[model samples]
Target chain A: MKVIREKPAVIQRPHNFCAGCSHGVFYRLIQECVEELGYSKRQIIAMGVGCNCNLTLSKIDTVDKFQCAHGRAAASATGIKRMRPDLLVMTYQGDGDCGVIGLGETLNAAYRNEKITVFTVNNLNFGMTGGQMSWTTLEGQKTATSVRGRDCAATGYPIHLPEIIAGQFRPAYAARCAVYDPKTVAQAKKYIRRALEAQINGEGYAIVELLGICPTNWGMSPVQAIEHLQKKALQEYPLGEFAGGEQAELAFLRQEAEK
Target chain B: MQMAKKIMMKGNVAAAEAAIRGGAEFFAGYPITPSTETLETLSFRMPEEGRVFIQAENEIASINMVLGAAACGARAFTTSSGPGMALKQEGFSYAARMELPYVVMNVQRWGVGLGMLDSGQVDYLRDTRAGGNGDYRHIVYAPDSVQELVDDLYEAFDVSQKYRMGVLILSEGYLGQMMEAVELPPFKEIRRPDWGLDGTGEVGLKQLCPTYNMALAHELLPVRQERINRVCREMQRWESVETEDADYVLVAFGLPARVCVDAVRRLREEGCKVGLIRPKLVFPFPYDAFHRVNPNVRGFISVETNDLGQMVQDVALAAKRELPQRNVPVYCYTHSAGVPRVQDVVRYYRSVLDGAVKEVY
Candidate 1:
């Protein structure tokens, strides 16, 4: 077969994530979107501290990249985009950084409708710090902190960021996606691309949550981890556009019916 | 009423206008008492000048916003008071590590912890030192009057950019709230350094904390030290009040310095050879001014607003370093959260003159 698409120049080095890590896949997709959007040189990204730092470590760069103090990426991106309205500003963060440490920053950035794109990877736990329980850890999910599985009564229910943000803040766009299969990966890319588009059109703040699997932390094979995500996690986090869609629920229902 | 071009402007507002004249293009701040006037003034003025200004949700967010703008090479700044200044410490460390330059105006409130909304110099130590985690010291400007505040801030951005480090303006609530006939500087051009983030990645990835590399830091450490030494060598600024031929010298900054001047004049009239050393830049703590003091100077006193007499420590150190042969005593006169009256300061100096007040160092 003839070689067609090549790796993005932005991905200058091999990433340091684990064997079944989804960070690499997500970073590649983001680079693709920036490339496709024709802002390959006119964009900047602020990555919150977490696995997102792997983007900088692996040399996944933009015109400029800021390794913002953990959880301050949203606020930092707010500053960047506001100062240079001509440049496309984006923030990449993990669930822990977004929901746990940087919660105020995330919500306020959305509330202000800052013209920046936000991408949060929800791996169910704080994967980088050896699978500690996170704000997004599913109920009854075991981790470093919650050895007996998560207790919703004690820790509160798993946070649904896109839904909360879409409902409360009325952002330009908000969506959740999974990367278990090729089709889902394509759908996740669509959400990411749409989130970028909303910012491009000056619609205001946009966020997309990508639900990816962690085989090492899940104590399962990569294939089994994907299965776990499909059979169990999917029930909790229904994938669809949550905001900025005319009939998001209806489209979600139709998508479920097709499956 | 505007007197010629000099307006009777509040200190904080004058500083805000001076920042605009000095080429600060971006401002992000959380409203805190004492410093809120600066934020409020900039909120509307920035838009009128077609610059960027944002009221962030909290102190951390505001400083981080400034960090982002500074990274892009915009002249950015933020303002806050005591507790709010504490919240901004993390962002300060991050900016320091990134070697990004920006200005922060702290209209200092009194006391520790939550402190009070009272105008005082309680933030002197924190503002003069690293003020955050790790090892970094930025240039600190301690302005006494509204005109001095305007003048200091007007040059602050350029100084920060020149050194590529944070520059702190230590403003007290007393100074911030009071009005003065001030002349603001004329508008200057905003600068975007060649190293600043432009649309192109031509400079390559502008790395954060290059000092993290031990090997690179081995070479970088000396350069960093030299910059600090150069700052000390070049930026020690102060105002002298009758210290040319005096047996006793008074060391102070900001509001205390203002009162100390009056106290110095009164003491001089009372047949006491007392003078005042008003430091305009606290971090480069005016050792040079000690050169102008009497060679046979009998003693030095630190006049301040904090209950504990914070700046006195620096007074002792500077005296020890600069007046090694004199071996003179260092005294401290302080007020608890309130600006001391000139009468009170003069009374304290009389006690010192009579050997009734003990020296702190």
Candidate 2:
């Protein structure tokens, strides 16, 4: 008998996401967590929508997935979770998708502390639909609409989602992490793992905000974009745990249950 | 015949009972008038069943919490009315677009702003057609009696789960406050699968994630719409009554439908040729069924409790497409402050039958 040693569900689709996009990194991290957790491919239900919406359906093959509408993936995931509490469900959203169009959903999910993990990629700008200033865009960040730097007086201040969510609800795990470099990327993965593990433990809502680089939208080379994220974005959006993990022993026990 | 126990249950309580009996283990809702009872009841009962219940700070957060719970594969629900429902529009839209199976109870009151907790069906149009800004439809069920309210709770969850769509239980202030005898179904414990986001079991590393992006979203629209259409076609169930020998039909839904039925019976007894068509599922509109009855009926009367007869417009559109050649004149009885009584509906039906009614639109 031949033994297969690959994750059952990831498709071999060529990566269309731009370099330094961080979506690819996020996807890999989620895939790694699922693989390590040892869940059956068919048991995993995924939903996605908006700019980075179809990323999962095109790449992941081992799980049941649904592509939802703009900023509505959380809502659909809510329904899925209600109907099939046995299936691992999660939603990956972008800053524009989650913060602006989906702010209500993000806040509500956190407030209710629903047992789902939200992976939010904050590139500050809307990367997919030309560079546009999103709600999370920094005050001086330039974009298609704000050819001039984003003015605090005109565009409002950049939203700190993790802080806002932490204030609203006690999620099982909440953190703002980055993937601009190897160390932070590893840290981000750990946070991602913690959030997903929270779901497995029925610990309620978990979220990870990845301070990602939008090379295309930022008008910087991939290397320059990483450097920019490290220097400028990290200072404004610090990376650290926002909630839970106080019971490290309990979390580890629950994490081991997946293996 | 056995005497049914008279339960002085509010509409919200009935809805809550139905949700609990139907195996809803997760409920997140912010308190609002007319619908607050549903959340209040769930807050106490869910924990008894080892379910998750949260009283969110606001309706926006309430609906989002529902989204989170639903994503974890739990049977989740939320309840609100008028303004609260409006606030929840974004989350509701997300639920529908994401193809999530959940139930929302809307105890509608009058309004464009902070519509008072009055007995009006003003939200019929918004809830039925365009609650959120997008090209999508929700499975809307408008129950008239307290019994229907309770029965439809289970039906709402079942339909939502089967179709992967959001189901709206549109109740009004009258129904929410009215007391009626109800036979409660035996409660059954819902067994949640390991995939729910509750984080209790071993999660596989390959589970799908919920995320939105434009490039990926565009590709799924065609498939998603196709799925929606399929669900709409298969699950378009409605409560309809007709007399084969009748000449006219009175079309209504929710509480107004009950009034229409009373009016139809009174008109028929008075030697008039009028019947009734009460739709239970208001979203899928029952166009084909309406068309089947359209040819035989001489005219139609639309009864609602809104300032501008919103549902009447749907009847007109259906009549235009269903019975184009038939001169089916529609008379609307629009009242915003309160639901028109049975006598009021009967009066309108009689006038329309007597050719003495004036067309408002």
DockQ score of each predicted structure, in the order shown: 0.67, 0.17
Candidate 2, what DockQ? 0.17
CA lDDT, every prediction?
0.88, 0.75
Candidate 2 chain B — worst ten consecutive residues by lDDT sum? B204-213
For candidate 1, write residues B139-236 as lDDT tens digits. 99999889999999999999998888899999999899999899777798877776766656766325557665676878788877887899899999
- Which lDDT tens digits does candidate 2 get at residues B137-210? 77898888998999989777777777667888989988988888787766766755444333322342113322
The interface RMSD values of the models, given in order, are: 1.5, 7.0
Task: Candidate 1: list runs displaced more than 4 Å.
Answer: A60-63, A245-259, B1-4, B204-208
TM-score computed on alpha carbons, candidate 1 = 0.95
In order of appearance, the predictions have TM-scores of 0.95, 0.76
- Tens-digit lDDT track for model 2 on A138-191? 889899988889998987898988888877778788889887677987888788
Question: lDDT at B277 for candidate 1?
Answer: 94
